[model samples]
Target: MLFRHFYNRLPLQLLSIRKHFLTNKQNYTVIKNTQTYHNYNIIPDVFDEAPNEPLIIQFKNGIEVDYGNILQPKDVLEPPIIQWEHDAKKYYTLCMLDVDLPTRLEPILRSFQLWFVGNILGQNYMETGETYANYIGIGPPKNTGYHRYVIFVCEQKNKIDYSPLIKGDLMLPRYRNHFNYKEFSKQYNLGIPIAGNFFLAQYDETVPKVYKKLNNLSLFVTPLK
Candidate 1:
């Protein structure tokens, strides 16, 4: 019985150590009240896994999002306009994930999915698609640090049946994190994204509002002093 108990406790001990290591290395700096800039030439982290391709994504407000452009929470209130090389008849999958979770610190560091739309016509996010998940604007908690919102467009070999992925009832707030985009892409054979872009969002007044609008879901809540 003692051996069995020790084995069971081993995983927890390793996890604790891992979290401690990551917490020290993870960059969780808060960028408050600073001039926002856009770098259209930046490259996203996801590109390291796949070859970079030209995929243009622009917000309705006329801002062209490249790899890692610095954008405000208000900048993404609406969906962005897409421009791809494929014809309109082709279908693709649109996915967004937060890559800045602070390791596996309970809820501290987990993937936050901002959007996921499947079976959409090429270069158009407006029509003929299954909305597996609705878009939620960035809501990084105050003092929680900055986050990178990476958007990807995966070209499907064929029209994918999203029924399997939709099995779990959408869980608000929690759905924003604990997602495994790498696994999801591989499981569904979605392959690497043909085009991708990313933006950074820091905690601000708009963050609380973004959380409130999303049914008061917040992974990290700053306690009132």
Candidate 2:
């Protein structure tokens, strides 16, 4: 019982140990919330794994989302400031999409790209990446219910060459609708996202107008049977 005796002799260390255990427990709770993403079929329906780490996202309107927290459409109208742990020397692809674009259950327009930035130096997307598509926030049509907005950070192999996809001095796919990230990633050799985060937003007064800000196409659909 030497260890017991040592622990009894150091109340402060025991307290520290207890505190550390609770901190880890809280972190685990946060990580476990990814189960909701899986439960919604967002896991296999899109990628294979639940994200391994946290990706922090905060909006200009003071909304911070990490674990699919439900946020007001008005608050996230603009692009969020995203940050995640990364290798400063490596490149990354930043992307955000609406997994439940038309409706939560039947999103025919699922994974409509809201933003895309290629070859960002680490997490510095603002200054380093070629912005193929500028940011557009949630615009889930009225009564379509809450939509999951997933932002993923894909670590890339090297500086991405845009010439292959560029046309008319700009990136192709002028409209953000109907994107296929898996194919795009394979084409560019971007491995699955190492880290990610998400938020939930429902249709609001701001949503009807949000579509007007995007590249070209927009949706206003009736739910399917």
Candidate 3:
């Protein structure tokens, strides 16, 4: 009876030991699996549907501009215009401008330009030029009569501080005293390029040639006075 009792206790002890060993192994395996999963499964290689282009918004009055493509004073110029500015106080800044494109087309145009500039030109406007009187002309399809008025907001690769002065040459020297080229270059090199751009196109309403083809069509029918 004593031998049988001892034998039974021995088996129980061995079973307990085996249970403890298996539990510890399972815990270790769980820890190892967690680490492996975090290292291999959770890390992302690229952003998921991240913005491939800048954000563009248009305001009422047919003016289109983007805000994401802002250029600091150190971008490249070979790629062309990066940002835009307009003199009309009503639509001067991004905050002030109101969207004018067709409801369905507004978002499309904005996104298209944002992606187009971001991928192709690699730059965008950082700040709006402060010259209130600046204006540029846009001719017809071939520079014909009654040209269109275009306001351009060009982005420069260098930082400019146009304070106190109202109007001057659009060259860097005009604002050289206010800019820090060394610091500007450091920031410029790190810049992702202009992230916003805009343009305002206004046409003459009274020009007869504006709708000459339409007028010819009307000649074939009864014209509305």
Candidate with top lDDT is: 2
Candidate 3 lDDT by residue in tens digits, 1-225:
998887677877797987898879846644553343233211111111112233344433333343222221112112233232222232211111112111112211111100110011122223433432221111122112221111122223433443433345322112211222223325434222112222323223332232242332113222112
Residues 1-225 of candidate 1 have per-residue lDDT tens digits of 998887667888797877886885423211110111123212222332532454577886698775556787777777777766676778899887666653212345456667889998776677787888787666766565556777778888788888776655454565455677667778888766776656777666676666666577564444222
Top TM-score: which candidate number?
2
How many residue pairs clash in each candidate at the backbone level?
A: 3, 0, 25
Prediction 2 TM-score vs. true: 0.79
Instruction: List the lowest-lDDT window of 10 residues for candidate 3.
Output: 111-120
Native-to-model Cα distance after best TM-score fit, residue 199 in candidate 2, in Å: 1.1
- Clashing residue pairs in candidate 1, if any? 101-109, 102-109, 112-176
lDDT, candidate 1, equals 0.64
Query: What are the per-residue Cα lDDT tens digits for candidate 2 across 77-166?
Result: 778888888999999888888887688777677667778788899778999888977776677777777888888898888887855643
The model with the greater lDDT, 2 or 3, is 2
Error of 3 at 90 (Å): 23
Question: What overall lDDT goes with each candidate model?
Answer: 0.64, 0.74, 0.26
Candidate 2 residue spans exceeding 4 A from truth: 1-8, 11-34, 163-174, 215-225
Question: Could you tell me how far off, in angstroms, the CA of residue 204 lies in candidate 1 after the best superposition?
Answer: 2.0
By TM-score rank, best first, the candidates go: 2, 1, 3
